[model samples]
Target chain A: MSLLAAGGLAVGYRRGRRAPLTLVADVDLSLAAGELVCLVGPNGAGKSTLLRTLAGLQRPLAGRVTLAGADLHAMDARERAQRLATVWTGPVEVGLMAARELVALGRHPHTGWSGRLRAADEAAIDAALAAVDAAELAWQPVDQLSDGQRQKINIARALAQEPQLLLLDEPAAWLDLARRAEIMALLQRLARQQGCAVLLSSHDLELALRHADRLWLMSGDGTLRAGAPEDLALGGALSTAFRSAGLHYDALEGKFVSLQPRSGGPTVALHGSGTAASWTRRALERGGYRVCEPGCERAARAAVKVLQQGWELRLGSSRRRCESLESLLSALAAAPVD
Target chain B: MIRAQWRWPGATLLPGRLHSDPLQRQRLRRALLQGGLLCLVLALFLLSLMLGSVNIPPDEVLRSLSRAGAGESAWERIVLLIRLPKALTALLAGAALGVSGLLMQTLFRNPLAGPYVLGISSGASLGVALVLLGAGGTLGVTLVAGLGLGGSLALAGAAMTGAALVLLLVLLVARAVGSNMTLLVLGVMLGFLTSALVSMLLYFSVPEQVQAYVNWSFGSFGTVSWRELRVMAPLLLAGLTLAALLAKPLDALLPGEQVAQGLGLNVRRARLQVMLATAVLAGTVTAFCGPVGFLGIAVPHLCRSLAGTSCHRTLLPACMLCGAALALVAALVAELPGSNLVLPLNAVMALLGAPVVIHVLLRRRNLRRVFAS
Candidate 1:
């Protein structure tokens, strides 16, 4: 079942005596239960605005946002909060609260007068902590936790709410490569385990592409496209929105390839595969040599053979067997230009 | 270290007893500490009553307190008219200033935020100045008692009105302003504006009127007679109660306003409520006791460090008790035993308060990050 569905949505701000400025217009998206969706865009691309709109943190300018079958804007904040939870990086004036206390705050909507925690609240908090792999951090102070640990705790806090939908704004924006992958994987597992739809915005496109169930590609033109990650990758939608100078989508690698194509340079034919050929092609491309396909599909002044035997460079009538790609490139450099 | 984790026992988590130790221990320790602090507050209350210039024998002071005699009885008059009210005034004023400071610091998320830092008292001063000087009189009423119950009541009322107006203006401006430094700077500027207006009033009024205003600005707890205490206590308690009620959202706020809002707290309403509580707490105290400095800014920080957590749940109550204790100590020191000379309350507070504020600023590595953003 769809937990949140936005149709004909528009989001932005209206300043004093000015017309409302839309950031994301006509955004149509639906998040089903247990789906992990990633929203990726450059700065000021309205990724946050879209997340805020979907989470009911901000009102849609012209569309209806239904959360758990109710109009998001029409519901009271507390009522909406019970069904939705959001996490983001901002200044937190954390007093002496432990990690558990932070997570317990997720139970705010369920808490009664004075916010006293009942048995169910405690059980939910504990289970949420366990879900996010943050159970061990329960007693530690929140401010003292590392960045990755903090993000995990943040997710646990949201999960503790037992909401039908979860929205996080860049939960892992400040971690190392390995940690980012871990956080992404954690979110993916959490969405499935808790059966709650999870949506997050992040600058790390690679991780999002690998782990997200769906992708919401927000562009600078205030438009967004939502589709399965593989479908977006296959349809060339990922590269279209992220394209910039010297950057193109590498269809083979499913990642953006930033290369300075050397125009009018003597080209060489790549005669191998695997890591050796790919790296050699990269090295040749970096040295201003265009590496053509093997069998010389196009005109080639040189053929660089990279095999288990060694790198064999045949430049016109002069053939040089070099020990490595470095020697081959150097040998190619010494070859007479046409 | 004082982050007391008192868990409500009725709630049991999965693997039920795994997390019970810290919660139960912290709760037990918190109870003991709070109880001990309560005892300390009472002891200081009694000490404040006993150690004054007259040095009335403790027994006589107790006797006079318990049973009143003739009109000419000096001990009875001293204990009843002077010490008891003064001590109570110190407790209420200190708690009020401390909690008010906590609210401002939490609301703005700035370490330097407080009633004094925000120029709240100066606004109160401006109010009193209007009543004393701008009222077109050679001599007029102030918060201190030169007149009867009616006069003191009128003075308090004027001061509260002035404070509320200034507080209203500050809260309105704070919503529009995002950065903590900008708000603090705005408060200082507002303080300056009120002070400037007050100076103009002083220039036009008689020296006797100016003198009354000056004494009022000097800051005093002893000036509040039993009658004025009646006016300040209920309001101070009410403000303190409001602060306690706000502790949860204030904790939610620790992660910042946006997160609090995400957690379902109405940030705008919560912010306004906090400001209202501060205005009432600071306004009433300033009206009754003048603008006592430093306690409002310093006490909250002091309590936070001692409690080892910023959770308003324990911190708010801790701040109140700690503030009461500090005020009593300050009151005792100002009394100057064995000498009839009483130190100016404002000067004493500044001397004590300035150090704490400076210490906190020095200790924080990211001063600019906390306020400038």
Candidate 2:
């Protein structure tokens, strides 16, 4: 059975006594144990509303959300918290509390009213710290730590809950490239080792594609397309979902191509096959040159040979060895176009 | 030379471990600090009892306190009748305001939030102002002469009602407002509205009534009698107990309300309980002590700095001990032992509290990160 399942789920907000405006509806989503899913979407695409609803933080406008085969909304807050934990993107004010103390608070559902951690609770906190590789940070004050270190503690706090399902809302939003990749890898490892389902909304589409086992792509028309990242890319679902003027998703490169191919531009015949050849092709294309293969019969303004040492530009029998791509572009500009 | 290491049997994670844990060491230090604060409170309590207009000796104060009715001497009356109740009132009221201030700060997640910031004290003052200034010509002059047990109860009851009403309004606004900052602004507006009503009442009232109101507004810990203490003590104790019991939720709230909810705390219910606790505490002290200032806003910041941790389990008790000590010191200073003149309680509190808060702010650069955001 799936760890979490939601069918016909609708989520949005209500204003006054008027009709509730549904941002997205008829959503069917499920997460199996040990699976990592990433929710990808544009702004105002109801990713937050959907994530909040699935986590039982907010009521779903339409249908049922079940966690481990039990109705999520029917359970008391503590019962639901014991099974599911959420990590948010917002910065937390931990005041003067130590990292271990903050992590121990995740035992709120298991402990008594005083939230005193027992022996079992202490072991869980230790395991959480170790899982996040943050044992060294356990004694440090949370406010004193850097943002990435604090985010590790935040994830550790959630892990201490010992939940079967974890939901994170753009947990890597504010982090830089290395830190963002670290968090994504950590979540993936947690799901694999602990056999808990991990689902997170992310604005970093490339990271999501690289790390997620499956992607839930939300379109502007309030539709969702879920499949393997490569499958979605190959099926053109990613491009269709994020369709905007002059924006295209390149499947081979696994990136969004926003620069359109220029029309009726100067032509260049590119030669050689290696990393240098591929990069030279890119630079030539970006420089508004129509780069042709080595054997194109079309009339060419300039012919370029990518040598082992440097780029050799032959403009009407005037050969010039360009040392760099910058110099090559500048040399190409200096060459006269007939 | 080998050093002998002390360890609790069956307590160490490893049987041969020699070093103690950092958390354990921190707990020990806080425990010692709290003990010191308790001693300070007791010493200040003694000082408050001993030093007044006509200075009474410690032995006389203790004798009067221990063995009641042993003698009807003037010293005994001064210690038993006047100073004892005044000191007890300061201790209880100060502790109450301190805990309430902590609750308000946590609930709103703002360092500037307190009973005064939320207009709770202003509500109490408006209630008292109505009784003393608006209806003074008919009712207050007589009530003022002998604010005996019954008349003081009436004032306390009125103050509680007014505070409850304002708290209800704030809670309603809290529900509608999107952020803590908005709720704080609305609370300040409510305070302004209540004070405006009070000023208008003062404008229309007789000069005698206006003087009565002004005297009440200066605030006094000495006005509470033995009878009033009987009423005030139970209410203040109950509020403090509630605040202590709420330490877990308040600590969870340090990260903000959404995370507190994620931790399985019933955020709405906890908020209601917190505001109710604040109302009971701030209301009771304002009733008998006449809107004592600075203690509510200052004591929590002082205790937070002294304790050096945001965990309210330690902070609540520390606030109670430190608040009682600070209030006793202020009360003693206001007494002006050698002189016949008594300084106003609020003036002494401002003189004492402002510097401690300023110093704490200057020393702790992370105060903004801890509370403002």
Instruction: Pick out the ten consecutive residues of candidate 2 chain A with the lowest summed lDDT.
Output: A239-248
lDDT of 1 by residue, A1-338 (tens): 68788888889986769899889888777999999999987688888878887777777789899987889989888887888899885434355668898898888878864778899999999999999888899999776787788788888888888889989898877788888899899989988887889999998888998999989888778888889888888898877877753467787888877755647777788888988888988899888887789777359988988769778887777777888777887888887777
Per-residue lDDT over B76-131 for candidate 2, one digit per residue giving the tens place of the 0 to 100 score:
88888898899999999888888888888888877877767778888988888888
Candidate 2 ranges with C-alpha deviation above 4 Å:
A259-338, B1-20, B68-70, B136-138, B147-151, B172-182
- Two-chain DockQ for each candidate model: 0.49, 0.70
Candidate 2: global Cα-lDDT? 0.85
For candidate 1, the TM-score of chain A alone relative to the native chain A: 0.82
lDDT of each: 0.80, 0.85
TM-score of 1: 0.87
TM-score of chain B for predicted candidate 1 = 0.83
Kindly give the number of clashing pairs for every candidate: 6, 0
CA shift of A129, model 2, Å: 1.1
